[model samples]
Target chain A: MHKNIESQLLKLIPPQSKVLDLGSGNGEFLEKLSKKNISCHGIEIDTKKIIISLAKGVSVTQKDIDKGLKEFCGLGFDFVVMANSIQCLRRPLEALNNIFEIANECAVTIPNFGYWKIRLKLLNGKMPVSSSLPAKWYETKNIHLCTIKDFEDLCADNNITIKKRVYLDADLNPLKSWFTLNSNFFASEAIYHLEKK
Target chain B: MKIQQNSFEYKESFHLLNGGSIPGFELVYETYGELNPNKNNAVLVCHAFSGSHRAAGVDKETDKPGWWNEFIGPNKAIDTNKYFVVSPNNLGSCYGSTGPATLNPATKKPFGKDFPLLDVYDWVASQNLLRKSLDIQSWEMVLGGSLGGMQALEWSISFPENIKKAGIIAATSLISSQNIALNQVARDIIRKDINFEDGDYLIANKKPRDGLRVARMLGHITYLSESNFKNRFGRKLQDINNKIDSSINFEVENYLRYQGEKFSEYFDANSYILLTKIMDSFNPAGRYNDNLVDALRHCKAKLLILSFDDDWLFPTEYSKELHFAAIMAGINSSFIELSGNNGHDSFLYANEEYVSAISNFLNHA
Candidate 1:
């Protein structure tokens, strides 16, 4: 399953291209790319995690994404990733726009809030709580949870074209059916591959 | 355990260069690791402001461990078993080296406030003299943090052909405005103290302890993060029974006061004044008129810049700026923003990830 996801992520990324991982926790993905001889770097907020990434011998910077991406200007990476961290951003759309200018291709992952379990909770006049969002509403760092459809609309509004979509099962397996219907009821997460139009 | 101390005189004083009358001096320092016949295993450990040649092991006078005890030794990051590390006390510091605190030959009195405002370049020049005196031409790696990192950067640039690798942690290409302002406040506190006596307190045989303590307290605040402070002290009271006393109230307040009191014990007020002033003036990027990117382009060592996430004093943003500058300058650079809550002081503490990151970088670089 890991190998399959790796392959899919690899297929989307250009070979040996410079990659920047935003909110890169311990640089797990960057380490994978480094093994493939890719020039990978990252920006993380947690100091301890940055140390872990450094110990792994990955190049990363500890930075707050809310500030801006001024540090990355002119040194364009081919790919920029916002893996599992977009929702935690203070300004998700603004950060996405900054990422768009910093990299040629962007890969973003957001929990599918439209999933049946979440929809049912909302229908019952209750805030949604699922395994993906384990924290209490007040305690959660996820300030902007966007559904797959909502994200698609956002991309369209921002003039970003979707290159591919990968819907994951509860265990992060890629679903074989239409993500809108199948993922809404079954899948746990979704990743969107996007590029500027 | 062979130890030798030597000093050299320079005809043209750096003080003269900075419009002072004191003469330039040099300090040669060394250490023992496993020595190969070729001496290729030697590592140069540079000292930060107020630090001495005593980078590792025990100091005879204090009977205490070295300043970088946490990260140096047999199996530490800059392991003494694998690498021979030599850290020299910078020329203008009040350690074993000659500085404002050193006695002048002509006047038979300490340079005191008469010492010149020394720059980072001057410190590197003194190291060069030490290197020549020791007959050591090149170092495998130059390692340091803070002012030490600034010296490492200067070493890498000034003697690009002499160093193989450089590690700069919790430091900046230029001292930030905020840090300068903080130092200025500390200086002002000391200057305002009646005991300061306009830096001419040598005859009085008394030091400005109260002012120095306050200065140390203010400076200490910047070294720690809010999260760290909250976790360690929060709103916790110092003593349960003394709630109504309204003195030495919170644990955090007591901690800061204790830190200030202890710091003033061994450190001199004048030395603190000079060092803090030097730190304020430190700008490895050089004068404002010059482009910083062009100045950084001179670095030849494979670079590793480390910053802590909670280090608001020199935040991760600053390290990112350095990484970008180094990349723009076409230097083989690596940057890491470590997850730490200890703020700027994180580099001196034990965070497993930080150790690993540095070890891995050193092993690979």
Candidate 2:
């Protein structure tokens, strides 16, 4: 799943482009991106992750993503990547706007809370737990969990253009099923390549 | 671990950053482990204001562990077995180094007030001389907390290529005005002592005991948080038995006075005055017209900054400032705000999380 996330991001980020990572945990992915000649700087607040990120010699600012990216406004980064972190924020709407303000091109990966399997679990009177949302209801870090449709509605409401959208299954594998048209109910998660309209 | 102090005397005249010069000086330092053949594994630990060369190991004479014994040992945070550790006493400090208490060759009297006032840059320069004397090409890491942290930051900036990494803990790039004011009160308390004699108490054959004692007591308040103080000695009285006589003393007062008395017994009055003044004026950004990014632009060394959330003396925001400058200057840096009640003194403690943070950052290849 981690490798799949990397490959998906690698496909969008070209060589020699500057990247800003919203929640660059441990700087592992940024370090990988740096190997491809991509300049990467990150903003992370977790103490353990920041320590590891620094030990790896990656440039990361210790900051809360919920605070937004006002300081980075107009920095003209080629890409601002938010991976599996949008659901954990208190102000997802403001964060989306903040991401669009920093760069014209950005990538956001989120767990689809509205997947069909999740609906079935809820219908069966149980809290949904998939690989994408592995934590128990009480243990979950997500405060703004949203479905793919909800996210798309948010983007549409804020004039964010969806350049390309890739749907992934429970194991984060990109699903190429015939019914991808109804992805809001089938996919467990998503990789979104968005642009500022 | 058993350790011995070593002395290095630079015969040439040592110049101060303040356009003053001393006719040669000596620096006493302690070393642990062995310097590698490549000469790149030396970790230099700069001492805080009242700190000494004894950063780790047991002093054979005193049978006491060094200040950072909890962090630097065979398999500790610095890992002495893998890296050579060197801790040096600054020039103006009174820990077996050339200081105000040391005899001057000019008139065969203690330098005292005549001792050229030194700054953080001077300490860094003197440390560099020691580094050259040891024949180390560049340091593996230079680290410290408080005043020591200032020295580490200075080393990274002044001798940028000479240091590979710097760990600055509980320090600020610039001393805030409130801090200067507090330090001023401490310095004035010492200076106004009847025996101070214009910082020449040594020549007068008198020690400013009362002045130094009161000053340290006042200075100690800023080093801890209110919650930590409460934890240690809140409203508890030291003497519950003296109720009839009403000679009651609070546990906090007793603790402060005890610490102050112990400090005054050893620390030189002039040295205290000079060192606190150095802490007063440490603004690297001042040279760059108050632009922190431009001040940090020339730094090639990677930085690890650790700040305590409860440290009001140098708050977490100050550490964040350095992180911001490091990022904007295109340097690799990381900042960690550890949660603890020890306040400014939190960096000196061996908190498990703090230890791991230091260990992982320093030992990373």
Best by TM-score: 2
lDDT per residue (tens digit) for residues B269-344 in model 2: 9999889988988877666898878878878888888899999999998898787777778777777889987989
- Scored by lDDT, the top model is 2
Instruction: Say what the interface RMSD of candidate 1 is.
Output: 3.1
Cα lDDT of model 1 by residue, B1-365, tens digit: 33334455565655422445456575746474654577766677787765777767777797977777777777777777776677788776766677766777788887777777777777777777666665676777787877788777778777787787788888887787888889889988988878878877665667787898889899889888999999998899788663423677798888888888887776767788788777777666664355666766777777788878788887766766777887777565777766787878877775677676666666653
Chain A only, candidate 2, TM-score: 0.94
Q: What are the clashing pairs of model 2? A: none
Please report how far candidate 1 places residue A110 from its true position, in Å. 11
Q: Which residue pairs come into collision in candidate 1?
A: A46-B339, A47-B338, A47-B339, A47-B340, A48-B339, A48-B340, A51-B338, A54-B357, A55-B356, A55-B357
C-alpha-based local distance difference test score of model 2: 0.87
At residue B210, candidate 2 shows an lDDT of 88
lDDT (Cα) of model 1: 0.76
